[model samples]
Target: MEEFNLQFSTAEQCLKVIADEKWQEGFECRKCGRTNYCQGKTPYSRRCTTCKTDESATAHTIFHRCRIPITDAFEIAYLVCGSPKMSSYELSRRLETRQMTCWKFKKRIMECIEHGAGLHLFDIPQKSQV
Candidate 1:
């Protein structure tokens, strides 16, 4: 697998990258079938012009409702992706988060990753290191 070096000079940059990747193809309204709604001007907000359902861009991600700044979330994602295996305790220490919070975050992240495991994007085949 290729390594990805995360580069974000600012929280805004990280959020922009995530938003671009998540909605590269554009966003569709959950309420209606319209595909014309543009991303909201707010940093973390997105609005559906068709249904007027304004939503946070991070509404469904692991960072949803998280008190931590978006930069922390980006750092967490990077660390999780890069590590081969990590326990909640280890993650907590690395991220300077509470153990309980780490546990919860780990659970949700693993669930999300598992749910998408079947998809080709996350279905990386195991390779034997020579």
Candidate 2:
């Protein structure tokens, strides 16, 4: 958990990283195909000026619709990527959360990592950076 804390001490910090990675190239409205955007209603969200579409840092990424706190989810990703041998049981214990929850998130991370054969944390650096 030291690494997780070092990289992201809070959920807001994690969201900032995601937002920076998501819009690294620039913002393009998913709905209007426009590049103009503004601060969204929610923290770390981007709202398209042209179409009034609001997108979250978690949207269209691995963290989308995650049930746990973003901080926990980020830690899971960090641990799973850094130590592939870790089990969900260990993860749950570390997080002091439900085993099933850790298992589910771990499964999702594995699926994404497998989907992009060479993927790891911060790899490929295109749209999704987790």
Candidate 3:
């Protein structure tokens, strides 16, 4: 795969990238099926215009429930996707994250690719429910 030149310099930038990519084809409210929505206080959240329900950009994505900064997670995912041979230790060094965290992220990404199961790191599927 070609290397992606995404600028994930900040948490907000990463969140915006994820949200735009996830909703590129357009998004509908899970609760009311409304196409319109409003941005939440956080860059990674959105509120439905119809039902006023809040949703996270990473809700159904591999980044879901992640404790690290979105930019760090995005960097990890990008590194893994771009260089499958990269070691977790190397990734951890590059991202300045804990080795265990890097290992877990790498393992999860590898499992997704090897099994071709669920959603891959870059493939953020829209959730059916918030």
lDDT against true structure, model 1: 0.59
lDDT of each: 0.59, 0.81, 0.72
Clashing pairs in 1: none
* Ranking, lDDT, top scorer first: 2, 3, 1
Which is superior by lDDT, 1 or 2?
2
TM-score of each: 0.71, 0.87, 0.75
Tens-digit lDDT track of model 3 for 14-102? 77777876777887777898988888666668889888888888766677777777777777777787788999899889878888888
lDDT of 1 by residue, 1-100 (tens): 1122246646777666756655667776667867777667678567888788876666544556656666655655566666727777887787688777
Clashing pairs for predicted structure model 2, backbone only: none
1 or 2: which has the higher TM-score?
A: 2
Clashing pairs in 3: none
The clash number for model 2 is 0
Worst 10 residues of 1 by lDDT: 121-130
